[model samples]
Target: MLNLEDLGEEGFLERLATWVKTRNPAVRISIGDDALVLRDGTVVTSDSYEEGVHFSRLYFSPEDIGFKAAAATLSDLAAMGAEPICFLLNLFAPPRCEIDFLKRLYSGMEEVCGRLGVEIAGGDSVASDKLILSCTALGKTTDPLLRSGALAGDLLYLSGFPGLSRVGQQALRRGVEGFEDAKRRHLRPQPRIALGIALRGKVSACMDVSDGISTDAGRLAKASKVKLVVEYERLPRHPELLAFAEQYGGHWDSLALNGGEDYELLFTASHDLPDCIADLPIHRIGRIEEGKGAFLEIGGELRPLLPKGWDHFSK
Candidate 1:
């Protein structure tokens, strides 16, 4: 019997996508990309966060947990170049959990939603053995960005620091002091909603860097049926993350390449793009080429970049 371990996350997703067919003509895009786009300009996406899997109470406050959960789900809407309208939350917690904790969690979500002009439409609550939070975000866009739109000769760009969140996660896990910037990045990720909206007619392809560049870029390349050659030396890094890596004896390059949970935007454009978009700096890291798969250009050599990012069922 084929189990989840053998299929892995991507494998299972591919198999599951095939098994579930979309017959509705209103579904313009589904089972692929960051979110599903409807013909009526409605975009929808959802994400789930479980205790001991996505976050740890040791470092995450109730507010932080709620904020991060909402941000993650909303980031998918941003990836698809949609402006978020509202979100539906589903909370599952044990009866022993305190009401104050739940209130604080909702407060965190409320703060982010208010900033983003999103509303808490409605949700369902259920009793469970562990804490679980799920969010379904809804948005609208006349023209949605897609993963399959990239073409050869397009320039690839990345926003913000890619590995800062991983550094923060490590610092919190190891009980290391300092690295406040990195920790904040992990605890509170800012979804690029404005940037996504700005990129509506400009970007050929775009996605959020949730599963590290090595994996997410590969997905983009596969979807576009092109090769993405990323210049290793050109990748932008934050000073705080570098310091954390050095102090903790971690490989900075590895973290930048494979560390996930950096909810920054990754995109490609055929035309020249501005260095900064609405004060957010964008770095030109690579280019799309006529080939297959993803590669790393480092030290005058090209190497195959595998998907070594987070996978729940990898053994």
Candidate 2:
């Protein structure tokens, strides 16, 4: 049996990359550079996640971790209004990790992949002191939905309600009934894959809400070089948020504006919006403008949409 522990991270990655390069003819490039570009596409993005930083075992299971990793990256693909075809996952875990952990993780990943009809082509693993997941999702779109695609007079739409994860987190902190459902959402977020594919060609610029809404929306608006006028009243809200709002001086709007891990798509349709997007709630939340900067209009009040998302480097 080969002992991967004996090799350092670099050596193991090199050997693994070489193995992949030799076995898979479809692999355009493998590990060894600042980044790896595996296949061809007009749009491509890769995301990395850490254990304690992104999630906690006490709050989420291994299966949940696997599901979250895959789902999150898929959302990025969706944001571009691209249809995801395949994925590559690289895992780093300590030797002491339980064997069942890997199985459950893969099982969760397989569940989401099967639902989305995405392929798990290949991945590389290695021994490490902690768990880290790096997923590379490949997608294709004849007309890619970029953040820069939003034009003036275009309407913005969101696939679903927000604040489930936030309320779930707070509920867990307070011991509530809906906490599990909320935690599950926080753990295994589902990316709007079908809707994204369906919205392709039908919409102008598109992107997913990974960071908080206010934060992510700002990103899309900035990328498009256009101002965003979001009608906060049009935003869909969960009962938990509405309930939590009345008692706790609810920042429900803020949560909806900037809550991370929703994994839903925030897209723009310059023409008429789509007639159908299944299994997910889609609503027109705002519009695009030719100006610069993003703002939110709520109850006849307007405010700047600040970039207040999850920034690992922020102090």
Candidate 3:
């Protein structure tokens, strides 16, 4: 029997995707892309966050857990350039879980939802050995951004810094001091909802950086059937993360490239874009070309940019 460890996450998903066939014409986008885009402009996406896997009680509070879980799910909708309407949350918790803890978690979700004018429609709950939160976000967009729209010569852009979340996770895990900015980024990531909405019809393609630049860029490249050459030096790095690396001795470039869960926007455009969108600075880090796979350009050399980010079955 083929093991999940042998297939890995991408291989397993590729195999699973073959079994999924969309017959409904209303589904503009079915198995592929960030979210499902319906004919009536309704965009939907779902994600699950499990304790110990996605988060840990050592670093996350009840509020942080709920907020980050919801933000991660909503980020998918943002990738599709959709405005969120509402969300449904499914909670799986142990019987011993405190009511106060659950309430505080819901409050955190509400805080993020309120900022985007999203409502918690409703969901189901069940008792489990561990805690798991699943969120399904609904949104709408007249022009949805697809990962397959990228073309040759399009400039690649990334909003905000990467690797801060990984830095934060390390800091907390190692009991290191300072790096407050990095910790906050990992704990309460702000999804680029407005930026995605603004990118409609302007960018050639887009997606959120939930799985790190190397992995996410590869997905975009494969979907669009093009090559993405990313300049290693151009990848924006947070000052805090840089300082952390300098102090603790870690490769900032590797972390920035492979660190996942940044929840930032990674996009491509064929034309010149403004330096900032709604006051958010966007960095042009690379360009698309007629080829396949993703590459890292450094020291006048090109190297394959493999997916080293989070993979559920990579063991």
Give the TM-scores of the predictions, in the order they appear.
0.98, 0.82, 0.98
Clashes of 1: 0
* Residue 252 shift from truth in candidate 3, angstroms: 0.3
TM-score of 3: 0.98
Per-residue lDDT of model 2, residues 195-238, tens digit only: 87777678887777777777678767876889898897888888
Least accurate 10 contiguous residues by lDDT in model 1: 240-249
Q: What is the lDDT of candidate 1?
A: 0.93
In Å, residue 45's CA in model 2 sits off its true spot by 2.7
- Candidate 1 residues 1-315, lDDT tens each? 989999888898889888998999999999978999999999999999999999999999999999999999999998999999999999899999999999999999998999999999999999999999988999999999999999999999998988989999998999988989889999999999999999999999999999899999999999999999999989998998789778878888889989899998999999878989967999999999999999999997999999999888876
Residue 54 in candidate 2, Cα distance off native in Å: 1.3
After superposition, which runs of candidate 2 have C-alpha atoms over 4 Å from their true positions? 1-43, 179-181, 247-249, 274-276
- List residue ranges in candidate 1 displaced over 4 A: none
lDDT of 3 by residue, 1-315 (tens): 999999998888889889888789988998769999999999999999999999999889999999999999999998999999999998999999999999999999999999999999999999999999988999999899999999999999999888999999899899888999889889999988999999998999999999888899999999999999999878897898789889989999988999999999899999878889967889999999999999999987999999998888998
TM-score attained by model 2: 0.82
Global lDDT of each model? 0.93, 0.74, 0.92
